[model samples]
Target chain A: MSGPKPNELIEKIDYNPPQKGWMDVPVKIRKGMYCYASNPKSVEYVHLPHARPWNPLEEDWKLPDNWKEIVHNAFRERLDRFRSFKVFMDICVRCGACADKCHFFIGTGDPKNMPVLRAELLRSVYRNDFTTAGKILGKVAGARELTLDVLKEWWYYFFQCTECRRCSVFCPYGIDTAEITIMAREIFNLLGLNIDWIATPVANCYRTGNHLGIQPHAFKEMIEFFVDDIEEKTGVKVEPSFNKKGADILFVTPSGDVFADPGTYTAMGYLMLFHYLKEQGLNVTWSTYASEGGNFGFFTSHEMMKRLNSKMYAEAKRLGVKWILGGECGHMWRVINQYMDTMNGPADFLEEPISPITGTKFTNAKSTKMVHLSEFTADLIYHNKLKLDKSRNDNLIVTYHDSCNPARGMGLFDEPRYVINSVCNHFHDMPRNTIREQTFCCGSGSGLNAGEDTELRLCGGLPRANAVKHVHEKFGVNMLATICAIDRAALPPLMDYWVPGVGVTGLTEMVANALIMPGEAERTTNLRGEPLPGMEE
Target chain B: MRLDELLTQKKTAIIDKWFDVVADTYPADTAGFIKRQKDPFANPVGGTTQKSLTVLMDELLGEMNHDKIDSFLDPIIRIRAVQDFTPSRAISFVFSLKKIIRNQLNKSDFNDHRILAELFEFDLKIDLIGLTAFDIYMKCREKIYQIKANEEKNRTFSAFERAGLIKELPGSGPELA
Candidate 1:
């Protein structure tokens, strides 16, 4: 009775210099007297003239009432089905540690984007739906009804989250708000409330078994296209590992790497690396099926997760490959390291991976026995199997930006870096928390692969770019290297935004470039110097 | 295959039938009695033909020493007190009142008919407004009903976890991670 009213508990005790007097003023009084009545969207409208992929409607497209009921019930069922991990993380203590940790919050100074508050919006609902206090006192107890408005708010903000799980690593309770964010998105998605940027790919993946929605013919065409690109760029007569059965390794990478940006270069690198391995009599078979590995739907729902992941296993079974290898994608590995075993199977199709040359068993496997390509390459280097020139990478100052999935999600902090340092002599680290488990995002992860919302992307990318910028300012880290495909897809555009001259490259790309050609001397030019196509000159 | 049609077809019918049965059994005259009882100018029950509640209200009034009902005894509280003081008799009274109100409700056909039914059944011990306790109670009741209606949802996630859709993080617990 004596304390601040229940509604006032979340009141801004901390305020800016001008608002000290207003902190204690009840929200009712503030609203009544025309206080901070400015619209939030006005800032975006005014500041971001070029923000493409604009949302024209506040409300999502609705289905018929009967259809709406079905959708709502389906979502409710999914909500009901959430595991302990879902419940545990949704009950986060509103600690501000994650607030400052978020790049979007730090860059834009928008309190709504702060990971802690972003989490609280949904956490309040969980408390209301599941807790005793919530049952006894409504909003006063920080429990609000699940109105259409709240769901819409969740759709907007949670999608903005990127499921980076960067906040989760720092949380005292280890609350991964990313999990809740994904769940919220999944619920919205069940109702067919989809945005074009992320959802189109998801629907594509569902329909065509790949996010790019490449037809089976187009998928094969992409491989051939990349092979030709490799021939043109590196003068290597590269061949795709297409439909080859019973090979020692079946390599798979993010399809984006095959189709776009620096990922295309990584795709080229994989081709060259496997070509090198092929010349060495390594009996490896690799092919791209509809990319079921890094399904954006994994970020949405279990149904989608099942639909997406089932393809890779199903494909692997069809091809009768001995082992499957995941390419450099962040969340794909997060799924592989964290969810794959639980999501899909005994994986009878996937044989335990072994070194093609050494025949040594890959004994220490993560949740799913599938090996991250970086981990495999790192192991190859550790065994002193890779013949390389460290000086070939000397032209560029290299720094490692650890992909979250491989580093924190899969506890693969050292392997990729070890491989990088082994292959390249000038390996450096970005500022603290820029590598390993504490890495920042490329801003376009978790299916935020949209051309619109570039402002939001830049805002999220600021923290990461700022870190890379510090290295560029001090040690002159000219080329940023990472292992995940999403990072490869995301970081290049971000580098262009903040530090104009700096570039991003995948670790495999660098390794492939430095790789000693079977017959020719490895002629590494300004290896990190020449601007790759699509990169700023 | 459409989940809404399945749930609505089954759950909605069950809820409607239950509502009708409960509505038919609730009292109609209680609201009129409460209205008439609260007026100070009306004759106080005394001497020969006093009903039990009339005597009780008289004593309660004497205790409060007021000609008119106190503002502290708002409509909800007064109604609750009257109902509480006449527990055995109140059940019969409420049923009679429900019978009278059913025809009117049918003619009106409001979407919030369920709200009225719930409000009518609310216990005297419940303080509905102190902190939106009424809404909270309703939500809790709804959640419980939801769990009952779709029992599979409550267990599927855990089963999936065991099935390996989500790998539990290290160190939380068998359930939490």
Candidate 2:
């Protein structure tokens, strides 16, 4: 028999460096850590520079000969476009408050996943190129040259971030690393360095009005299909209106919800809720053209985001709708809350979103004239408009996973909890440290939610899953209820692998289960046909 | 005293030594979480590490009678699997327990024949636990890779299905429009 094979008992990982003046350390691009490159056609469609097929693992990335100049010019333009970029770049005092705040760092234990160090990966390059102190002292002042290796390092680390903004919540100066990541990704895209995850969605949404690239006719067909599923489940033959002119409200949700499993169930919930509302004489319509609410362009660049976001308002004006109702999504709200009005707003043609049923005026959305689905549903429950049976969800021991964007970016926490609690009796909160403003990412946010980046997603996802696993073991929590569409699609596999037996559901799905729609058949099972407690004979 | 009685009496000490050996693998701050927090929600990684290590050591020192070694080892090994440890490094803590037990027994009863035979039997049990840990560690890593592949396939599921690459078959639940 072979004697004990020789290896270090303690792992050898000396690559992380000192406080400053340490720029020569080579970044290790281990397999299963980074995302695969974007498709050439996707990059080209978005008009990104140097759009060609490239692999992250290959020796040659095929970057342009003048790539450094192009990246510098792009950075300089962003420094002009956004003042926050300059503030985040220049104003970090390197306080360690945000270090332990990142779920990525908590999960991977790589110092680079720490928001401070992740930003420093790009900040070092910024100092080398633009800052006087960095130019004078070189690596001594925590600066490094923009070599090809440095570009790769920036790409690797930036994509590792979900741009969840968890660290910015704790920053003393309120330095947003999401701002830095968005800018870095834009620069990477200039040289056609894009992950297929983000690039494909941006291109698809630009071309087909949604990320799934469902053509106009096909988009209608998808909803019609969901309508049939609704009839089968709820025994309500409710026809949904699509792209009809003069509709009062324009509803748009993330395209992923329309196309993916579990997310499809959330989409079904929206249909059932809207069907009941329609039967009550409220007039709303979905637009085939502005069919998506999520902005993958938010991951690519702000300008790209504006291009995708303009469609929603344009569709509202085209359909002659009064206001917009955004469905369950995370980053969509971050854009709507912070960027939409300033970017493409006044939305002068649309009236403020007054709930046709509850008569609640959404004053917070007065400027953008858009209301979140949770806020709408919560108001419905508050005004005692909908008939909800709490026992429908008695089989589920539920907990809410606060999606990162809505949590940190908008502080839209209580509205979702309000909605979930109104519908389900079994609501539980994860540990206080891991929820609300300090919420963890679903690991695959922004464009990093793509399949090829599964390992990175799973690694980054561990902290969130570990938290869920905790509640799973402690509270006998069988279902993880969330409000975001991405969380619905992404959290199931996360639960399956990291914390088995804990299922995932959207708040709206739980709402649909509990909603006692008038003239509807007696409920035998919740959404997805899972048997209700007494029905499980 | 009989070797079985002597072994039974020292079981707590043996288990405590094993607990220290594995828990010491993490940083002090991380180790403190296990030492301090009993609530799993407050500290899951630490909680699993503490609970699983306790059960693991008990199994090794006792009759080693149960096939439920996996129930104890899997939780601990799963965490170690995702950590930045080499396969050898992650499983080495298992082997370290053998050294500690040998040193303890050697000091107490070096000359007794009956105790030496019992010590040999106990050392064999420790070897089996180490092997069990290695198996669990490999399974965890494999699960991670399998999950990544499935997610990648699932994320792009509808796109391919739309292109007629993935066809609809009955009993597959709803169709992708």
True contacts kept of each: 0.00, 0.23
- Where model 2 places Cα greater than 4 Å from the true spot, the runs are A1-25, B1-47, B63-68, B83-86, B99-122, B152-177
lDDT by residue for model 2 (A1-537), tens: 665434433224221223322254567786766777888999888788788878888879998999888988888888887898988899999887887667666665566777988899888888988899999998888888888888888888898888998888899999988888889988887788878877888899999999878898878877787777777777877778889898889999988788887888888899888888886667888888998999988988778999999999998988899999999998999998999988999888899889999888999999999998999999988998888999888888998899988888788889989988888788778888789987888888887766555556766777788788778878899999888888887887778768899998888988988888878887787778778879987
DockQ of each: 0.01, 0.28
Which RMSD values do the candidates have, in order?
26.1, 4.1
A180-263 per-residue lDDT for model 1 (tens digits): 777676655545544555555566666676665666666676567667656555567766667677666667677777665566
Lowest summed-lDDT stretch of 10 residues in model 2 chain A? A13-22
- Model 1 stretches with alpha carbons more than 4 Å out: A1-80, A89-91, A128-132, A232-235, A521-537, B1-177
Question: How closely does chain A match the true chain A in each prediction, as TM-score?
Answer: 0.83, 0.95
